[model samples]
Target chain A: MSQKPEKLIDKKGLRLDGRKPEELRSIKIEVGILPNADGSAYIQQGKNKILAGVYGPREMHPKHLARPDRTVLRCRYHMAPFSVQERKSPAPSRRDIELSKVIRESLQPAIFLEYYPRTGIDIFVEILQADGGTRCASITAASLALADAGIPMRDLVVACAAGKVDDTIVLDLMDTEDKKGGADVPVALMPNLNAITLLQMDGILTFEEFEKAVNLALKGCRKIYTMQKEALKAKYESVKEVEE
Target chain B: MPTFFERRQLVTPGDLLAEGTYVTGENTYKENNKIYASRLGLVEYEDKKINVVALRAFYIPKLGDTVIGTIVEVGFSGWTLDISSPYLAILRASEVLSRPFRPQENDLAKVLDVGDLVIAKIMAYDRAHDPRLTVGEPGLGKITRGQVVKMTPTKIPRVIGRKGSMVSMIKQETGCHIILGQNGVILITGKSLKDEQLAMTALRKIECESHTSGLTDRISQMLKKEKAKQKEEIKNESKT
Candidate 1:
């Protein structure tokens, strides 16, 4: 890895990715990509590419793991060995495990798990490329896949990250900015309900900057909410086109 | 007193269908005086009630419905069957044979071995236990000499059409014995391989284009074209 320049933002207020201070990376989302899986999605956020597959509300194995009252949610977050600049090991790392747990918890609030008692829904997310904000992008793709699988839910989950770079608070940091940045905060929300599902912060930030960063991240999440809804609605609209 | 969206309006989960004095039906839940869609489906407003019809979903077994199942495991007294649902269906030896008792004397596997296909009826089911199946009913027993086609449960209704009209058309045209299962399994037996192949193509076409309009007309046209093409090929073969 190489060190970034001392100044992440220029006097013109543009970051290395040629983005404004509050600009997010380009996001692309597609649903129902994997025919075999009950539901699947592919997402691209700038240079980061992620694929998510969902199966279940089906039978749970090792019978004892089944929840008597509600459906159990299982999530696996993995980064491909060649995803990063350096070749990483294929084994699940501590960070991967932690991210998986957090992503599952973040999506739990949106699902109506009580509808499928004694069953389990499995979510698998693999990052084929990494820039930054992979966790947020993973959550976005997973939620779409869940909806694609026809699982009942209260709302879709949207996520975004904001960080302070070079003493300037910025939205949606890239890899270089994240490595050299200060106080990276990732936020997940249920946009329809205006509720936050996951909020985690690392590094240093002052009280005012923290508040600003959270507000910026929430705004980014709302923007993502629109994209997610469009992706889902597009699937049905295509059928309507044929009807006419 | 109730307001409803036009039929076939697409809705995603959690989307608000309406907010008023109205009765809610399947795939729609009411919360705080507002009705919300619970599935990715089409909205239907019926006689003062609102509901969303799911586009695709897993099959939920219901009592007294005949189903096609494959035996996966055999116990001392019953056989474990996979009905393509989340729960495993149980078929007892008594249900397999009309005669009573003597589980200790006869081997259950002999009657229906693992991997054998059977057409059975769901006798009972609830949240606590697996559904019980029975094969003693007429036309319900081991399924042999037919090709089975699996499809999405939601598309099953479209394939069957209203009052079995769609399916009967296919059977009449192709001369295949068609058994429709609510759980997305169809058994088709024809007089010859050509007849079976014709029916298969028609059914697959229906499944793929289940959401479109005027599908019955399209299917009938397709069947006619297929028959004509087959006759042309046969004439060419004779000339050669």
Candidate 2:
């Protein structure tokens, strides 16, 4: 384990990665990468690599769990053993279960589950590499996969993290900033609907700082939302070109 | 009086298709007099109605649709068939048997065992129950021979083309009998394996280029070229 650096912010007031306090890390997204999956997407945000696959609006296994009047969404969030610096166990850890539940809840609001009664949509998100904001990236990728699968969604969900590092709040905390930062707030938003789907905070933040962090995270979400739309359309660019 | 996008324009979830009492259709939802796309698809306008033609999607069963399916389970009085949909379709024993159905005397598996393929019609479908299927039609029964090729359900229209041009062309060119299932399953049978494969390749080309314009003509040209190539190879083999 590396020792925590004494200064997370440089003299120019930039974060350790030379990003402005309100700037986000680079993000790359691709859709329909897995043939077997009904829908799939891969996301690379900074050093974090995540893959999400969507299967269904199909029959639910263990039939009793299916609801009579609405479709059930099942989510699984898992990290590969080598995702972190140390080898994490492949089994579903407590944190993974909690994240899976929260991510599912975050995504539920966007889908029109009532269209497919008694069926199930399974979203599987695997963190092949982790930096700090795996959950947020996973949500972003998983939502794209759902859209790619042609599921009815009111809007696409996008997420980002903001936190206080070296007494200065920053947009999109990296691993070093998250580990040593005073506070971290992860927020997911449906940009079109202007609704916050998920919000989580850890460590300490003053009320004013919390508000700033959330607004900053929402700003980041909105920025990523445009990229999300582009990625979705890029998957269909061939179709569009041929139409023209 | 205003629409946000052009007809057949690519749209993703949350894109505004139109506003002010535009009746929403499939893959679109209305919110406060505004119609928005509910998935990734192309905008389609018919009169005052707005629908999004999804590019990739699951097969939702509808009444009177012909489908190819594999029998997954032989139940007591019916067979559960997978029609490539979220729900399993039920092919009742009574629908298949001409005589008065006596369950005790009948051997259901002997007729349509599990794993056997069939060309069936969706007799009924509703949200309340699984789709009911029937194989009583003359051309819609057990698929004895040939291969089943699957493509995206949304691409099936391209296989048939407009007014049955693409499919009929392939049928005439390859001498292959092709049955297209609404659920994206296709069954091809021909005099020889080579002919069947030609049909499959032509279908695959259609699936890949379904979005392109003038696909019917292009596919016809491709098939003609391949057929000529195959004949030349055969003639050379005879000489050798």
Q: Which candidate has the top score in TM-score?
A: 2
> Which residue ranges in model 2 land beyond 4 Å of their true spot?
A238-244
Query: Candidate 2, residues B61-157: lDDT per residue as tens digits?
Result: 9999999999999988989999999999999999998888888999999999999999999999999899999888889999899978998788888
Instruction: Classify candidate 2 by CAPRI docking class.
Output: medium
TM values, all candidates: 0.94, 0.96
Candidate 1 shows a clash count of 0
Backbone clash tally (model 2): 0
As a whole number from 0 to 100, the lDDT of residue A128 in candidate 2 is: 95
> How is the predicted docking of candidate 1 categorized under the CAPRI scheme?
medium
Considering summed lDDT, which 10 consecutive residues are worst modelled in model 2 chain A?
Answer: A235-244
lDDT of 1 by residue, B1-240 (tens): 344456777777777778888777977888788887877888878876887877767777899988899999989888999998877889998787778848688888788899998998999988767789988778999987988898877778888888978898999888899998878888999999898999999998887677677888889889989989999999999999
**iRMSD for every model:** 1.7, 1.6
Cα RMSD over interface residues, candidate 1: 1.7
- List residue ranges in candidate 1 displaced over 4 A: A235-244, B1-5, B101-104
